[model samples]
Target: MTPMLKHFRYLSTSGIPRPFRSIPGPLSLPLIGTLYKYFPVIGNYKFSKLHINGMKKYKQFGPVVKEEIVPGVNIVWLFDPKDIENMFRCEGKYPKRRSHLALEKYRLDRPNVYNTGGLLPTNGPEWWRLRKIFQKGLSSPLAVQQFIPGTDDIVTEFIERLSLIEGQNAIDFLPEISRLFLEMMCLSVFDIRMDSFSDNELYKNSRSTRLLKSALTTNSCILKLDNGPQLWRYFETPLYRKMKKAQKYMEEVAIDLLSLKMSIFKDRDENSSKSLLDVYFSYPELDFKDIIGITCDFLLAGMDTTSYTTSFLLYHLAINPRAQENLHKESVRLLPEWNSPVTKEVLAEAQYAKACLKESHRLRPISVGVGRVLDQTAVFSGYEVPEQTVIVTQNQVSCRLEQYFPRPNDFVPERWLKDTPLYRQGHPFLLLPFGHGARSCIARRLADQNMLILLIKLSRNYKIEWKGGRIDTKSLLINKPDGPILLKFERYQC
Candidate 1:
């Protein structure tokens, strides 16, 4: 037995604490462990079906499922909310999450271009240092409020574009929603309006187009490399090379944008309000490269995640008539008209709109669950989990269980609202779509504002109708819509 296990076994006198080795899971083989089960033609599991596989594992293994995904990487999947609470409680000062190791390698490979593997993959003191610099400006509701006008302008522009395409055949929603989100991120980060909605075919060459392609490529590569065999680590596999190229292109674009923004920011008057880029530039400790890294992280991180979320929200609203009407009522009360400004004040009063978004999050989380590498040892579900064990809380699965949410399969926005009869005060740790504590999503406030605004405006402007098959999710690092999000937007005759 290893020193840590020996110590834990000796120290834990309580009979309730189960041995870490006692965790039940599929039989793991040597070196490859359970990874062979994910191989093509022979493997039973697919990485994209992580959420489904997780649910099956929970039912079979009884919550604490242990699996060695690769040779040296063992993960303990926690399904119970109480165990999840203990997991977070064991998280020390700097919470470290295990993710995107391939991306981390790519960034570290290019010392000249990247200081660290931007925000998503980095952890420990380096991650904390960077997080602290960013938290003040990005994590606050007030900070997001400043960009409301700009964000709403893009929302209005996108809504106009939607109207022109409304009565036509069912529109594919993901690409269009992604473009809209990219436009919003660019405006907030660089103070530049990417005419992504323009009819001009030259939009093919727009920064938004290139950046979105690169971001998608990067996300795809990360999933393949991280989940596949460890061939990339030993040498440059084709997939690894592809990811490197995409990341390099993204890095180049970020650097160029940061430089351009710096020039414009210097020329602006002292009285002018700062954009998100300007705010990052103001930080004395952050150099140009730091700003570029962060800017790229912010843009890439938000695109697919937010777009998928917005797409799902619209899908739910499209199907659930009562919920849609309730949201529409709220939006009309706050917005009054289609072109009404989405100020912070307007968003604050949008109670139903907020609940709808939250409900969507619960139903379809962007990630299967929150991941954490504990710094201290903690017991979970009677198992004495050692420090540094990677624990993935099955947030999506837990939220769907009838115990946690009544009518788990149904779309019920009322559950989130305290005044409603459907509301149940479930575990605090359940339904953490954005995570919790210091390491929660930094873009939480901004993403919420952007999605809520779109939800309200879309509801107010059009009666959403489904136009395609039931939307399922396939994990691409984060859970993304598996099929085309086809929808019809019928303009409301107010």
Candidate 2:
């Protein structure tokens, strides 16, 4: 074992007090630190250097090793499931790190619901407040029930779109699925009909959406440098102008929707309990801009993540024909017909279908993991993590750990079954596809439900096979299939 791992193991077994165990690993460089090494190469591909190196570093340092990504930024990488649990329990004490370059660029000029704060990105008391408000909408059994029709409609539309692509045809599932999901998000959350697939104006002005989509995929030191005040001022070029224009387009779309929602709310009777926007507006003290920010947060978070995950699921299913058969069998047994809307009851019974999704997420999580900034100095194992230190748990790696999974590299849905030892010892925090802790994904239920429903519907209707008998996975902010997930769909005959 490496010194870092030895140190971590010692800390775990030793009865040392909190705040005393020194965090192990290398020191940061004066200014650029490891950023020059890690950031320069993370260009617009599927996986970040941080993620690639993080797994390598963990192998060398053990579960609780510390490393410097940049000067003064000490990142503690936690790989052990036990360590993950401890960190999650301490999450409120350790909130989300400040917005990074990409987030800042996106949010710098925008006004919407997140202006007040939302669950996935926000932290502190403000996050708690917004989460409470958002939870009321998401967690309400009635509200979730109400959302079913919209979700069903969108997923059905998505399957129909998939049907148009013939066998072995190379298609970019990224943009196509992104548009489908954005439509679903709007319909489900705001009762708004984006119909982006059909609307020319919406399609034409969606440059901001395109940019955001591209930003997530492309790698650039220039993009990173542009976020820094000093560097950004010195490098006022066309690329910067393009980003600014994109940001403006994004803001316009958000504001337009916010204004429309507000006008409708204004005209409605106080007693009308119709949409999520109406419910939110009922609370008179909350500002409209904040509402818009939070709503947009939902829109952005929901769209990219679900679409990317669904894409990954489709790719995996296309490649693994036996897994596809298992999924199809499960779907047929549970919801034999695809004509009806997928209900929670039907989804709950689709055991293998759910397992396939869980396994897919396990292998190719949207994010490598979530990051939490230490609110104050804290100790993990035998290390002192200073205040403002960024702590990241490798959920992707955890899913592959032998302690948590048997044959971690293989896709086996039966492994998640209740009687299995894997299920018994499974670490909730470690297996988080939606993350864990005080700032866990608020849209967890919605994202989960949507993915499962889409899978169930797709599997029942079509037998998905890969083009030329090969599949490739890629990583951006979210992991997805590299090429358009090319597939031949043989329609199921009833």
Candidate 3:
């Protein structure tokens, strides 16, 4: 029998609707279907980058296409901004992300230990409650503004730390940026600096850093399971053991930190200072384990995404000297001092710098797209998508289209300057790396301020020159630099 015949033979009677199947994609094979689309060989690499592969299929199949990660698991991919907006509006009260099966399983396996799955997994009333409990802290504008000075101090110290490198050799900058971002996040979240380099023994290479590492590693392990079959859950795989062990370590550390904070909260004056930690502590009803889980979630999300985005931003500025020079000119014209405490007022004045960052986000979003698991049926691309289906905004793909961006791949921050047609005509939904609506990233404000501050300080002090090969990216959820991000930064003469 032919391959198409064999596939149809095995396909369930009500499998995929004929109309839906006709949307656009490669020929679905006997059993693997469009899985071959993911593995199309290019040079030496094969199926290594999922999002890039998705884009190739998007080009083949029109704006809306269908791809399967595995057999029987069908997903509708969207590239239109209008469809993304519709999908966002259709996300009911408690929007679910395509739920992380491994993370949810980890929570369920330790039900007593994790009574309420934190913000990422839980939905319905449970998610609503969890979100309400922490949103004020995680999404607070005031908290972000308050954090600026402290984070600025860290950014400065990080720049200075970079100078200590002995040679002109290319720096493997990812870990350095990760460490600095973690320190800032620690100070913001726990009101404690999580630094690797410190004068005091207690502060140097802190336990919090270790716990954060474990959390990230465990998350990576869990996501690995997510990409593969479900048989790992039944088997005692080494990977599973390591993840569970890391999870346990994270829980223990969280309990210890909670006790320490609780002890301090009793004697400490309420007006001492405000922080994300203070906000979490205010909700005493929240379980200790869940708080730890949320902390881990925030650390993992907060550290890498912001740092990698900033790194990629610098990569662009490095390659485009004109953008960097323009940004510096803006900063010099707008601010009295580059190293001073960053305020909202300063951020406002650095509009062009902000635009440059926005341009980078448009060109190279950390995540290729964002999704919401629908709660109600919605019509999209002339199809009636069912309830509980995952609707993704291919933001990366949408933002890159020439029809929308007019030379999409090129880095042109000027297009973002006011009075430009591209600036006036672009829809807000065209490039949402963070996401949109009430379900958007809680740390958006924090991420923005962090990037803006880094851009200002880095542009002020150094000339970023790209010493790396082609800038390539890989994503589990948030994309990170796939190759060595080698750059040369010469101190500014001015």
Candidate 4:
């Protein structure tokens, strides 16, 4: 049955959709739904603060509980894997993930800046079309592999740069790695050299740094305007205003760079060594504005997630010395020579290293879970959910649950080894950090390669140890270390 028809039937049979309303959830007060039931609202300023207590919601509400962020929007949190399977399967060829309402507003307000939708907010045929074109650019195995030599040099140079930080006073490691990722991303995606450590380098005024600064502003705006009060939609709040400025800066810079590149590439003949920009230039169907939009999305995602994940892996290794030792053994055996280049085939040999990265991801996921706005009504966990409801796969909660994993609290990378009885067989649906189906991250391979190379090199050169007691995670757009992660690194002696 159609979700709309089902909803209509339920409404006509009863004054309201009792089945929908009957779903277990927090108390919903008038306009704000059940937000006030768990959060604080002081005067004009109101904060749902979901990021700080996201897992708590799953605990307070059951496996399939209703949450109304505002009057119209209803979010259903599903921890059961069965329900997640249905939702993912129900998502048609072009999966519909959450659309950033604030970003949509920006696109509407400035048609010139955001002429066409990019991956983040685009859906249906438009999303599918752009996704295919985008896949050809980044997702293709050939695309990322073509740049391996460049990516390897970038990582090797970053390790050299990282080594310079040794013997210095205890320092916050997050910002340091964030820069490395940013530099690597720029080199890979834009064909831009962004090494600030080079004697002739200028970071503050460089195009890469400028893009990073503008992206930070735009991201902060999206988080506030996207997750903030619904009332912000009516007025131009300070955040929205800042978002406009940031987006404009981003658009202007992108158009200028893309236009200049197009002009430069216009004179050159077709060649096999085309960069991503070159690939886009080859496609006559793509609009200049769209090229800018896709590039912007690349810049946005490229900045944070991989760096955050790498930091967490390092942290896990530092805290769990046994895991670190195990990884060291694996690294030494697979890579007897520490300075070797990491190709996909070579990376496949480093089983323990991959397991360590996976363990860190399971423990500290970037988001609470993957979200899919359903287009069809489907049964989830024995309940009939209506259409257009945001179904969240709370893997962050499920990954740690003892029911799915034995001794879920312990950081055991060996649990991922194939021969062990602890190895899970068929739970891909339960543990998706980058999401699943067609909507999975386009940069999955690129990000994975980046993290693996950096970690392998890092472990080879130094023994990482966490001096500060238990660090917390903060979830905004990305889940990351809450504060400065103080860790001690010693040079490995022969």
- Give the RMSD in angstroms, all C-alphas superposed, for model 4: 4.2
User: In terms of TM-score, how similar is model 2 to the real structure?
Assistant: 0.84
Find the 10 residues in a row with the least total lDDT in model 1. 6-15
Q: What's the lDDT of the predicted structure labeled candidate 1?
A: 0.84
The global C-alpha lDDT for each of the candidates, from Candidate 1 onward, is 0.84, 0.66, 0.72, 0.72
Q: Per-residue lDDT tens digits of candidate 1, residues 164-231?
A: 78876688878899988888888877888767766662375666777888888888778778756769
Number of backbone collisions per candidate, in order? 0, 20, 0, 0
Candidate 3: where is the Cα deviation over 4 Å? 1-18, 26-48, 199-219, 420-422
Per-residue lDDT value at 468 in model 4: 68
Q: Model 4, 130-240: lDDT tens per residue?
A: 888877877666668777777778777776666676755466787667777877776666666656455444367665556666776665566556554745578878887
Better of 2 and 4 by TM-score: 4
Evaluation by TM-score, superior candidate among 2 and 3: 3
Candidate 4 wrongly placed segments (more than 4 Å)? 1-18, 37-52, 196-210, 267-272
Instruction: State the lDDT of candidate 3 residue by residue for 1-494, as single tens digits.
Output: 98545433433234443455466655556666555545536232133464676677678777777655555656777887777777887787878876456666777777777776566667788877777777787566666788888888898887787687623668877666777777887777777765556644234246655665675566567555655545666875777777777767767765665667667667778677766777887787676766876775676578778878888898899899898998888766655564566677888788888899989998878787887877766556665566677666688878878888888899998888886655646887898878887777788898888889888887877777888888866765567777777778787666
Query: Residue 221 deviation, candidate 2, in Å?
Result: 9.3
Candidate ranking under TM-score, highest first, comes to 1, 4, 3, 2
Q: Which residue pairs clash within candidate 3?
A: none
